[model samples]
Target: MREAFDHMYISCWEWSISVLEEVGATKPLYPPTMLRFTKRDTNSATPGPYSYPAMTLDECQLADFSEFETFDNYCYAMFTFYQLIQQTSGLSGEVNLEVRSPRFLETVASKDDIFLIEGMHCVKFKNDRFEEKVMAHWRREMPVRTFRRKDRA
Candidate 1:
């Protein structure tokens, strides 16, 4: 489960970086020079090292979710995971995607975070077995799967 999550998170960065490169982003943007990881608190943690990609809006060079069909779904899953943690474990932090790119924001119609959930519904997983396994783990870990997204609309 953790492995799949790590792969998907890395894929998001790689995909976004490639798109930035195609559009002639500067040298520092081509190959990521710095990568940041947050260590989980051992006293109250899940199994394994469990570090996900962490970045701030200031660090974002591009917010391109174009052409990639699974991109929104990945974002939706990530947001959902954080929400689940907060609800199930009483964690405090919030997940907010404050997209700085006005051009990218223009492409998306919905102002609400529900757009991710809705967009995810439009795409299907290619690998059935992998999807099933992941979903099963999700079900076990997170009993409450659906929640209302904060409406910015």
Candidate 2:
């Protein structure tokens, strides 16, 4: 029920007037900048203990999480880490809906190269070399036009 509530979007949130008393009793606490969490538990070994701050793309890049070429895969890796945390603590009572590399960079499909997946086959290729090959193949068939200013022409 807690997880379901976290995932759901509600138009209304119930707040009690106890906020007035709490605020009067304590120092002013600033509002949180982010709500989503990608927590890690050091005790778990499946997801390990290392992580890049995943709240933003800049944070991920700064943390050198370059192994993930796409955002979806990066998040999948984070989720896996937290899952291991729950599993180790015996807190996982919900069904897991994802299957991915244990660590953020352990993608079973491709790591540092481009891959083409067809049916059950995974074909890996050199991305830069492939681009060059395609360009060379079509270079002669296609013509390039140089644009010049009217005055120069």
Candidate 3:
């Protein structure tokens, strides 16, 4: 599973690079402008490490997903490529993709402490299973006076 995760991450990076090249966009010095990693504790930590890939808005449309058939083919190609890489690498983990704001830095200091931007969704792949979840946290702000009732005094 770890191998799959790593392969997915690497593939994502390569794909991003390819997209930039195809679109004639200036590639950043770093493949990923921002990176976030889950936290670990000494007391209960796993032996292997985990990571994922993230891309900016400018990077997303480079593939020209405007062509549905071509885009679908691209996705299949990515899936097959990663599967082969995982088989050869002997790493066992999952591949997960999440749509997030390019300004992720302003909200999330790290993967474990993510603050979801208004319009992002998380897609996760684990143990050959895929799932999608909304990243937004829904909450209502309460009036301050409600907590400080006059009768309480």
Candidate 4:
């Protein structure tokens, strides 16, 4: 299951990078990022000692993640990250009002996971002009999984 989750997570990240590239906004958008792969045995009977290695993406190869998968999970991840960037940079109002190709609608229907589903809803609001009724519906819906960072300290 660890490997499957890792594959899913990495695939999601790759999808994000690909969408960013399609928009011709990779350099200005993707910050230096890292992925730390970890595995722990949930069964108490088996482990004597175990430590998982954290891997950092080399500067030159960070863009390679863009090829992880062809699924819509990538586009949703990009939208989520873009929102994060806007919030962090305090430039939410400065984002372009124009919608671009590979629009959220094009990719949303293909998503299989709840995280990506909620992500699509959020992206819809962020990218297009929606009715107040529609916006309220999505806002009321809860996401399946909230992103969390492992405690490293």
TM-score of each: 0.22, 0.18, 0.25, 0.25
> Looking at model 2, which ten-residue stretch has the lowest summed lDDT?
11-20
Name the Cα RMSD for model 2: 21.0
**Candidates 2 and 4 compared by lDDT, better number:** 4
Better of 2 and 4 by TM-score: 4
Task: Give lDDT per model, in order.
Answer: 0.34, 0.29, 0.32, 0.33
Better candidate number, 2 or 3, judged by lDDT: 3
- The digit string of per-residue lDDT tens for model 4 on 1-153 reads 011112123433444443443333332211123213334334632221211212222342343444434323333454455454445335433322233323443444235232222233232233442223223333554232222222210
Cα misplacement distance, residue 67 of candidate 2 (Å): 4.4
Q: Which residue pairs clash within candidate 4?
A: 15-74
lDDT string, candidate 3, 1-153, tens digits: 111122234544444433333333422222232233433344652212233324445565454434333423333333443444354434533222242334433333124122222224322223222111111111122212111112331
lDDT of 2 by residue, 1-153 (tens): 011112112111101111111222111221233223434443642231122221332332355333333333333332333334344334432222233222323344345332233223223233465344433433443342111222322
If the candidates were sorted by their TM-score against the true structure, best first, what order would they fall in?
Answer: 4, 3, 1, 2
Candidate 1 per-residue C-alpha lDDT over 68-98 given as tens digits, one digit per residue, 9 for 90 to 100: 3343333435444433434433332322323
Q: lDDT score of model 2?
A: 0.29
Worst 10 residues of 3 by lDDT: 130-139
List the candidate numbers ranked by lDDT, top first: 1, 4, 3, 2
Runs with alpha carbons beyond 4 Å of true place in candidate 1: 1-9, 28-95, 99-104, 111-153
